[model samples]
Target: MASDGESPVRLAAETWESLFRAQVAVMRKLQAGPAFKKVALNEYDVLFTLSRCPSGWLRLNELNDHVLLSQSSLSRLVERLEKRGLVARMAAPEDGRGVLLKLTDAGAELQKDIGREHVRDISGLLGPALTAAEQKELRRLTEKLRNSVGARH
Candidate 1:
């Protein structure tokens, strides 16, 4: 039954469609860039997090949380990065049982390159569509939405 003549079915369908379209648009924009070709976004995120870490190292668990990846998935990603000589894992000095992930010089360089490419891609996609003030407003709204959703958890 509809409340106050409101069409719940139509509303829900429209919401889903909007979300799907937005995701596809954003993904298409990101995928058109050289960064996507050079490294999968998730891998780049992991590398960027490590690159920003103090001493270029983060505990395995800390890195996993930052990337929002499952332990198995992060382990697989780390393994691949290690094989590429972009990251290395070592036992934590304070706790030999804990592992620490650190970026290699190659990883650092890759992160820098990808960061630049990402900036260029984003600028190309939205630079003309929005003025600086509009961009600032969009960032503000995005943060508000993020915080609202985060509060629900």
Candidate 2:
């Protein structure tokens, strides 16, 4: 049973639907924003992911794990980024068959530029709807949920 005495399964499903709808609503707005004109959302996601890596290089397979795209789709997107000179690819030193990826100088700069705008866009959308304390609580809850779901990253 849930805390309010409703069935646990029903509560879970309702909660999931709300969360999913919220994400979709926000994503649609963000996707239509000016910042995304420079690069598609998925491309920016790759750049953003690489920017967070403390290590200079991240393996392609590992990158695949973090992203929502299929492996073949990611491979194609990485190819496009490489062609645009935004990302660099190298063979993994330890494994001849493994590919490694990292952002180029241009990619890093673009990510920073886009990220600044993205944060502002998010703030404008969420700020009025949730108080600071509520935002903090939401973050905490989401992180807990993510952890509970066995995310390796």
Q: Which candidate number maximizes lDDT?
A: 2
Off by over 4 Å in 2: 3-5, 151-153
- Clash totals in order: 0, 0
TM-score, each model?
Answer: 0.79, 0.95
Enumerate residue pairs that collide in model 2.
none
Candidate 2 displacement at residue 60 in angstroms: 0.4
Error of 2 at 82 (Å): 0.5
The 0-to-1 C-alpha lDDT of every candidate, in the order given, reads 0.86, 0.96
lDDT of 1 by residue, 122-146 (tens): 8987788789999899789778877
The model with the greatest TM-score is: 2
